[model samples]
Target: MPETFLEVGIAFAGIALASLVAAQLRFPSIPLLIVAGILLGPAVMSAVDELRLMQVFAGFGIVLILFFLGLEFSVGDLLSGARRKVLNGLLDFAINFSLGLAVGLLLLDLSPLGALFVAGIVYISSSGLIARLIFELQRAARVETGLILSILVFEDLVIAGYLAVLSSVSGGTEEAASFLQPALALGIVAATIGTARFISRGAQRLLERIVSDELFVVAIFAALVLVAGLAEMVHISSAIGALLLGLILAETGHVERIEQRLRPVHDIFAGVFFLHFGLTIRLENIQAVLAAAAVAAIISILGKTATGLLAGRIAGLSFPASLTAGLTLIPRGEFSIVLAALAVSAGLSPLIGSFTAVYILILAVAGSLLARESLRIAAWVESLRRPKGNTTSG
Candidate 1:
C-alpha cells in the first residue's frame, strides 16, 4: 500500500515537471501531459503502474473540464451563436465529416457503424485545448475568434445528439431496437434544457442563500455526479449531462466563483485522466496501425485546414485570418478519445482505439505548433499570393 502511494506520488511529480516544461516553452501543457503519461505508462518505460483510484479521479476530471467549458457559455448564448453561425457551422461539418466518413468507408473499409464512429472522431475538436490556445496565442480578441468559438459551440450541441445516437447504436444489436434510444436521448436533451430554464432562478436563489463554502461545493459536485451517472444509465453520455449542468449554472451569474472553487479539482483530475488514458493504451497496437493512422491524420489535418479557410472566407475574413482559423483548429484531444472509446466498446474495431491514440498524439502537438505559427504561416501565404510589390490587405 505504501508502495502504491509512492508510485502515485512519483507520477504526479512527473506531471508537475511536464507542466513546468510546457510553461517555460510557452506551449500548451496538454500534449506534454499526454507525453508524460505515455513515457511513464506500461507501453513505454513503465516508470509508473496504473493507479486504479486515480483513474476514477481522471473520469471526474473530464466531467469537470466539460462542465467548466459549459460554464463559459449559457444555453441562450449557445442557441444564439448556433442561429447566427448555422450556415458556416453546417459547411464546416459537411466538409470535415465527409472527409472522415470517406476515410472510414473507403480508405479503411470499416463497417458502417465503425465508419460513423470514425467520422465523429474526425468531426469533433478539443474544446478544452482550443479554448486555451486562443488565449495563449493572443488571438482571443481577433475577429476570427468569435467565429471559431461559435463553431465550437455548434459542435458541442451537435455532439450531444451525436452521442445520443451513438449510444443508441452501440448498445443495440438489432436494427429495430436502435430507433428508440436516440428518441429517448433527444427527449432527455429537450427536457434537460426545459428544466434548466424553469429552475435556474431557484438554483440562483439557493446559491445566493448558501453561506457555507463546503455546502456550496458539495451541492454542485453532487448534482454534477448524479446527472452524469443518470445520463450513463439512460445510455447517453455522462459528458452531456455534465456539460448541460454547466450551461444551466452559467446562467446563475456565479461563473467566476464556481470556476475559482472548482478549478484546482478540475486540473488535478484532468491530468490524471490523460495519464490513465495513456496507461490503457498498448504501444504495439498503435504500431500495427501506424500507416493507416498516418494517412488518417494527414487527411484530417488537411480537411480541417480547408474547412476553416472556407468558413473564414464566407465570414469575410482576410486570407491570413482564415488560415489562422484553419491552423488553430488542428488539435484533437478529449472528444476524439471519447469517440474512439465508444467505438471500441461497441465491438466495432480495436483498430479505432489504436488509431486514435496515434492520431491524437500526432495532431495535438502539430495543432499546437501550427496554431502558434498561424500568423507567420498566413503572412507567408499572403506574401506569396500578392503581386511582388503589392501591399498586404485586410
Candidate 2:
C-alpha cells in the first residue's frame, strides 16, 4: 500500500523532471517521458510495480487524446470531404501497409500472420502523439491540418476493421463465428457514427441542461468511458469509440468549453501512456532486433512521408505544407504497440514485440524532431528542385 504510493509518487516526479528538461530544450515532452520510463523501468531500476494501474491511466490518456482531436471538427466536415479523405487514406494505407508487409515477408522472412502484424504496425500513425505535436507546434490552423486529421480519422476507422480481422486470425479459427466478429464490430461502429451524425443536436440539448461544471465533467467522462468500454467489448479499439464520441460532441457548439475542461486530465494520463509504453520494452530484446528494426523504421519513415506529401497535395497544400504534413505522420505509437502485442500474444513471434518497441521509439523521437525542422527540410528539398539559374529579384 504505502510502497505502491511511494513508487507512483517517484514515477510522477521522474515524469515532471523529464517534462521540465523537454521544455528547456524546446522538444516534445512525449519522447522524453518515454525515455524517463525506460530509465526507471523493470529493465533498469524496476522502481514501479503497479503495472496494471499504470496501464489503466495510459489507456485513459489515449482515449482523451483521440477524443480531443475529434472535438476539432464536426460531422458535417467529415461528410462533406468524405471523398478526398477516403482517397488520401486509401493511398496512404496501400503504400505504407504494403511496404511493411513486404519487409516482413521478404526481408525478415516472417510467417504470413507475422507479416500481417507488421502491416498493422506500419499502417497506423500515432494519433495521440501527433495530436500533442500539432498542439505544441501550434499547427492546428495550418492548411494541411485538416487533411492530417482526415487521414488519421480514416486510420482509426480502418483499425476497427483491422483489429476484428486480427482477432480472428489470432484465434486460428476459420469458422464462421470468427469472421462474424469483424462484421459485428464494424456494424457497431457504423451505427455509432450514424447516430452521432444524425442525432447530435438532440444529444447536445440534453447535455446543455447540465450547467454545473462538476456534474458536466463527470457526465462527459462517464459517457466517454462507457462508449470506449462498449467498443472494446465488441473487439474494436476503445480509442476509436472515444474519438467518435468527440466527433459527436463536435457537432455541438461546446467544443471549446469541453476542451478547456479536459486539457489538464489529458496531460496527466497521456504522460502515463507514453511512460507505460517505454516500461514494457525490454532493452536486451531490442539489441537482438536492432538491425531489422532499423530497416523497418527507415522504410516506414520514407513511406509515410511520401504518403503525407501526396495526401497533402491532393488536399491542395503547398510544397512546404505537404512536406511538413508528411513529416508529422511519421511517428507510430499506441496502435502499433497494440498490434505488436496482439501478435506476440497470439504466439506468432517474440521478435515482433521487441522490433515494434525499438521501431516506435526511434520513429516517435525522430518524427517529432523532423516535424520541428520540417521547414528546413522543405527548403533543402525545394532548393534541389529549383532550376540552376532560377534566382529571382526581391
Candidate 3:
C-alpha cells in the first residue's frame, strides 16, 4: 500500500514538472507529458506498473475529457446549419480516410481490417488536442472555428459507426455473427441518442432539484460511469457514451456550471490518460517502423490540411482562416492511440502499434507548433502567393 502511494506520488511529481516545463516553453503540455511517461515507463525506468491506481484515474480522465467536450456545444447546434456543413465533413473524411487506406494497403500491404484500422488512425484529428489548442490560442470564436468543430462532430458520429464495425470485425468468426455486432452496436447508439433526446428536458429538471455541489458532482459522475459502462458492454467505446451524456447535458442549460466544476478534474485525469498512452509504447521497436510512420505522417498532415482548407472554404472562411483551420486539425491524439491499441490487442501486427506511436508523436508535436503559429504562417503563405505590386503597406 505504501509503495503504491509512493509510486503515485512520484508520477504526479513528474507530471507536474513536465507541465511546468511545457508552460515555460510555450509548448503543448500533452505531448511533453506523454514524453515524460515514455521516459518513466517500462521502456526505460519502469517506475509505474500496469496494475496501479493510475489506470483507474486514466480511465476516468478520458471519460471526463469527452464529457466536457460535449458540454461545449449542444445538439441543437449540431442540427442547426448541419445541412450546409455535411458536405465539408464528408469531403474531409473521404480524403483523409482514403489516404490512410492507401498507405496501409499499398505501402504496408496490410489486410483489409488492418488498412481500415490505419485509416481510422489517420482519418480523425485529435479532438482533445485541437480543443485545447483552441482554448490556449483563444481562437474559439474565429470564423473558421465553427467549421472545424462541425467537422469534428461529424467525425465523432462516424467513429461511433466505425467502432461498431471494428468491434464486429475483431470479434466475429462466422459471417452472420460479424454483421450482428455492428448492427447491435449501432442500434444501441441510435437508441441511446433517441432516448436522451426524448428525455433530456425531464432529466434536466430532475438534475435541478439536486442543490448540493457534492451530490451534483457525484450524481453526474455516477451517471456518466454507468452510461459509459453500458456502452462498453454493448461493444462501443465508453468515450462515446460520455460524449453522448455530455451532449444530453448540454441541452439542460446548466453546462456552464457543470463545465466550471469539472474543469480541474478533467485536466488532471486527461493528463494522466495521455501519459498512460505514452507509457504503453515500446520505444525500442520504433526504429524498424520509423520510415513507414514518417511517410504516413507526411501524408496525414497534407491530407488533413487540404481537407480542412476545403471544409473551411465551403463554410465561407477566408483563405488564411482556412489555412489556420487546416493546421488546427493536424494533430492526432487519443482516438488514433485507441484504434492502434485495439489493432495490436487483436493481433493485427505489433509493428502497427509502434508505427502508430511514432506517427502520433510526430504529428502531435508538429500540429501544436503549427497551430500556435497559424496566423503568422498563413500570412506568410498569403504574401508569397500575391504579386510583388499587390503587397499591401502595413
Candidate 4:
C-alpha cells in the first residue's frame, strides 16, 4: 500500500515538472504530461505499478472536467433557433464523419464497428481546447471569433451525441440485441436532462447550507460520483452525465462560488489524469505503429478542415472567412482520449484504444502549434484583403 502511494506521488511529481516545462515552452501541457506518463509508466522505467487504480481515478477526473465544460456553455444559446448556424455545425460533423469512416475502412482496413469508432474520432471536435485558444488569440474579438464560437458550439453538440451513442454501443446489451439503441439512448438523455433540471433547484439549497470547506468539497465530489454511477448504470458515459450535472448546476446562482472552490481540486486531479494517461502508453508499440497513427492524424485534420469550411460556406459566410473558420477548428484533444477510453472500457476495440492514444499524442503537439499560430494566420488573411482603392478609378 505504501508502495502504491509512492508510485502515485512520483507520478504527480512528474506531472508537475512536465507541466511547468510545457508552460514555459508555450506548448500545451497535454502532450508533455503524456510524455511524462510514458517515462514513469511501466512501459519505460517501470517506476509506476499501480496504473489500474490511477486510470480509474483519471476517468473520474475526466468526468469532472467534461462536466465543468458543459457548465460553461449557455443552454439557451443552443435552444435559440439560429438555424443556419446550427446546420453548419451539423454539416461539419457529418462531412468529417463520412470522410473519416471511409478512410478507416479503405485505408485502415478496420471492421464495421472499428470504422464507426474511427468516424467518432474524426467527427468529434475539441471545442474546449479550441475555444480556449480562440479566447487567447489577439483577434478573438473579431467577427471570425463569433463565427468560430458558433461553429464550435455546434461541434460540441455533435460530440455530445457521439458520446451518448458510443456509450450505448459500448455498454448497452439491449443496444446490441436490437435496433433500438439510438432511440433508447435518446430516451435516457431526455430523462436525464429533465431530471437534472428538477434536482438542480434542490441541490442549490443544499449546497448553500454547507459551512465547512471540507464538507462542501465532499458534497460536490459525492454529487459527481453519484451522477457518474447512475450514468454508468444506464450505459452512458459518466463524463456525459457529469457534464450534464454541471450544466444543470450552472443554472443556479451559486455556481460561480462552487466553481471557485472546485477549480483547484479539478486542476490537481485533471493534471494527474493527463499525466497518468501518458504513462499508460507503450513507447515501443507506439513506435511500431507511428506510421499508421501519423496517417490517421493527417486524415483527421484534412477531413475536419474540409467539413468545417463547407459548413461555414453553407452558413452564409464568405469563402475566405469560411476557410479560416474551418482551419481554426482542426485542433483535437481530451474528448478523443475519453472516447478511446470509453471504447476500451466497453471492450468495443482494444486496437482502437492503443491507436487512438498515439493519435491523440500527435494531435496534442501539432494542434497546439496551429492554435498558437492562429493569430498569425488571422493577420495574414487581414493583410490579403486590400480595401477598395482610395485613388480615383484608373
> Candidate 2: global Cα-lDDT?
0.81
Structural similarity to truth (TM-score) of each candidate: 0.91, 0.84, 0.89, 0.88
**Clash count list over all predictions:** 0, 0, 0, 3
Candidate 3 residue-wise lDDT, 1-394, digit = tens: 8878877777787789889998898766777877888887888888876535776887787788777866765766767887866887799888999999998897677899999999998898888779889998999889889888878878876865686679667867788878787788778667756666566898789888999988887888899999989877766667767877887888886787787777787888888877876677687767778888889888988997898788877777899999999988999877787677668767887777778878888998889888999999999999898988875669
Residue-level error in angstroms, candidate 4, position 245? 1.2
TM-score of 1: 0.91
Q: Which stretches of candidate 4 lie over 4 Å from their true place?
A: 173-182, 194-196, 315-320, 374-394
Clashing pairs in 2: none
Write model 4 residue lDDT over 1-394, tens digit each, in one string.
Answer: 9999999889888888987997787666776777788888877888888888888779877987887776775456557767866777777767778876885687667777777877777667677567666766665766556777776777666677777776776565663533566566667666655666677779778877888988987888898889888887766678878877887887666678778888888887887777776666776667655787788788777776676567766667666666667667777667776776676666764566667777777777777676566556646765566675643567
Number of the top candidate by TM-score? 1
Candidate 3 overall lDDT versus native:
0.80
- What tens-digit string does per-residue lDDT give for candidate 1 at 229-254? 98888777777778878878888977
Ranking by TM-score: 1, 3, 4, 2
What is candidate 4's CA lDDT for residue 130? Answer: 73
The worst-scoring run of ten residues by lDDT in candidate 1 lies at: 75-84
